[model samples]
Target chain A: MTYCVGLLLNEGMVFLSDTRTNAGIDNISTYRKLFVFEEPGERIIVIQTAGSLSVTQTVIAKLREADEDPDASPYPSIMQAPTMLRMVEIVGQVLSDVTADISAKVDRMSQSATASMIIGGQRKGGSPRLFLVYPEGNFIEATEDTPYLQIGEHKYGKPILDRVVTPETSLEDARKAVLLSMDSTLRSNLSVGMPLDLLTVLTDTCQVQHQTRIEANDAAFQEMSHAWSKALRESFTSVR
Target chain B: MTYCVGLLLNEGMVFLSDTRTNAGIDNISTYRKLFVFEEPGERIIVIQTAGSLSVTQTVIAKLREADEDPDASPYPSIMQAPTMLRMVEIVGQVLSDVTADISAKVDRMSQSATASMIIGGQRKGGSPRLFLVYPEGNFIEATEDTPYLQIGEHKYGKPILDRVVTPETSLEDARKAVLLSMDSTLRSNLSVGMPLDLLTVLTDTCQVQHQTRIEANDAAFQEMSHAWSKALRESFTSVR
Candidate 1:
């Protein structure tokens, strides 16, 4: 299980994802699920993945292979796609192809081979965009009315997002919103664990502005998590 | 789809259920999902249900028949059960039987006929007890460590309960906790909606203490809902 959220707002975009992956309770392990692709001042793409680790990791690896070795394919690479929409098509096609390839091999044992992703970033002439890509090679973009996309272990953390986030929200507040939302999930669910990846890109810059790995023992994160819990308990008591 | 939660607290017990039922987004109806059976001084049983309406409604109807007309059953009826444990057996047996009867018919059409329930109450000689009954006719009681049970559309409402309620929580605060939890579910999900049925019983009383049908236009509930949203927004902004 995993939890990843991407917010598209007036200021820019925000992406956050947990690092935990598990085949079963005893086999839990930490794996990086957020990938960043960039050619400064040209194009920037951030992908957050959830579900079948084999499929997602392969998709990311394949994307990177195309990105680093442009001659390996006839089509343009992720960083060379004409627009965010075309880049999503490329990612989705790869995701669908990899899923089908793996499912055929694993079908004899009745194992699943599927994954989903949330992609958000910008290419030079296009405005910023955020999307939730499905395992079936289809996708949907986040719009002003609903400017956020979440995948995997999402319900426990959704109420806070539904209550607080919007298109006009500030970049700083968006960061806090996703963190607090993740805080609620971490407290309620054990499947989504810490050492999170947090990233932000300012609108039109086509570059990663701020990025950090929030380890489980990160003091600032721990303090904010504790403070949020204390504030929620206090606010609950005063609701009515 | 439905949302129903029951909490067992030191002071008493709380049970709440939404009234909406839908086969799909287009076909929805309002129906009562909470039922109470009490002999005032002998025993009390509260059942809140979710899942297939056919299974739940029949379970309730058969339990009622066994209670009101004792000659219809060969075994001890729900009201005549010797203990809270025995009462749960009676309810579980009826739920299982009804579900099996319905599933055999619905199976031919490739549709679901499964259901789940949360039951909490006390007999005159026993302590308060809460149990979640699954479709397989098995059940698990809530413990001091986890003093609440929820069925159907529960995850969105879970974080608040995890943070606020405990066995030491008071009955009044327990009511607020469940209501606010339900409010969160209502905001984030479309399948769970008003009007809601709210009921509470003081421990050892063998009877209900407060019961109310909160209609859609309910004024006090509306006011509390508004106040809660305001308090949460203010708290979210201040958490940093």
Candidate 2:
């Protein structure tokens, strides 16, 4: 289980992913689920993954391989894609291919190798975009009416996003919304744990404006979590 | 799909259930999911159900039949149960039996005829109690550490309960907690919707203290829902 959210707002885009991954309760481990693809000022793409670690890692590895390959021209690569939509298409294709390849190998054990991703960022001339890519290589883009997308352990963290997020929201508020959303999911679900990877892409910059890892003991994160809990309790009590 | 929650508090018990039932999105209808059985001052039991409507309705019908039968003593009936534990046992057994009976009839369709229930209340000489009865003839009591139980579409409504509920929580707060919890679920899930059935049992009274049906147009419920949304937004904005 994992929780990752990406927002497409007027100011830019926000992406957050938890680092915890587990094959079972006893097999828990830390793994980065956020990947950044950048060509400096040319294009910037952020991918936040959830589900089978093997599949997501393989998809990322394949994407990186394609980006580095000179003969990869015929095959779309995240770094070279002409638009955010094309970059998502490339990522989705790799993810779908990797999942299918791995699932076939593990089918005898009746285990799934399915995974999903939140892909968002902007290219120099294209508008910023956010997409939720399914395991089948299909995807849906976030629009003004619903400017946020989440994958994995989503429901617990969804109400806040549903209430607070919109296309016109500022990047700072978008960051807060995703963090608090992650906070709610972390508190409610043990499967999703800390050391969170958070990134923000300012609109048209085609560069990662802010990227940081929030550890379990990060003071700012702790303060935000505690404050949110206190505020919720106070709000609940004050509600007539 | 349904969402029903029951909390066992020191002051008493609180139960809430959404009324929407659906086989598919296009086949939705309203049906009450909360039922109360009382001999006033003797015993008061509340059953909030979720899952296959046929199984729950059959189980409730059987319990009613046994309660009205003069020769039903050989079989344990909810009205004749000796203790809260025995009452849950009776309900669990009836639920399990009806599920198996109906499931057998529908086995050819490969569709499930299973249901779960949250049963709570007090009988004379017994303490207030809450049990989550499974499809099998088994159940688990809510403890002081975790005094709440939820069934069906539960995850979306769980975070607030996890953060706010306790055996020591006041009855008023418990009602607010469950209602807000239900509100969260209603907003996040299309399967769970109004009208809602709410009931509370006061400690030692062995009778329902308050019971109400909150229709979709109910002013107070609408106010609470709007207030909660506003409060949540205010809280979110105020969080540093």
Q: Best lDDT goes to which candidate?
A: 1
Interface RMSD of each candidate, angstroms, one decimal:
0.9, 0.7
Model 1 reaches what TM-score against the true structure? 0.98
Model 2 agreement with the true structure over A127-162: per-residue lDDT tens digits: 888999999999999998888899999999998888
Q: How high is the TM-score of chain A in each model?
A: 0.98, 0.96
TM-score of 2: 0.96
Residue pairs clashing, model 2: none
lDDT, model 1: 0.92
For residue A8, model 1's alpha carbon misses the true position, in angstroms, by: 0.2
lDDT of 2 at B182: 92
Report the C-alpha lDDT of model 2 over B135-161, residue by residue, as the tens digit: 997999999899999999998899899
Go through the candidates in order and give the C-alpha RMSD of each one to the true structure: 1.2, 1.7
Instruction: Show where candidate 1 strays beyond 4 Å.
Output: A74-76
lDDT, candidate 1, B1-240, per-residue tens: 899999998889999999999999999999999999998977999999999998999898888888888887654687888788988988888888889999999989998699999999888889989999999789999999999999999999999899999999998888889999999999999999999999999988989999999998998888888988888888888877
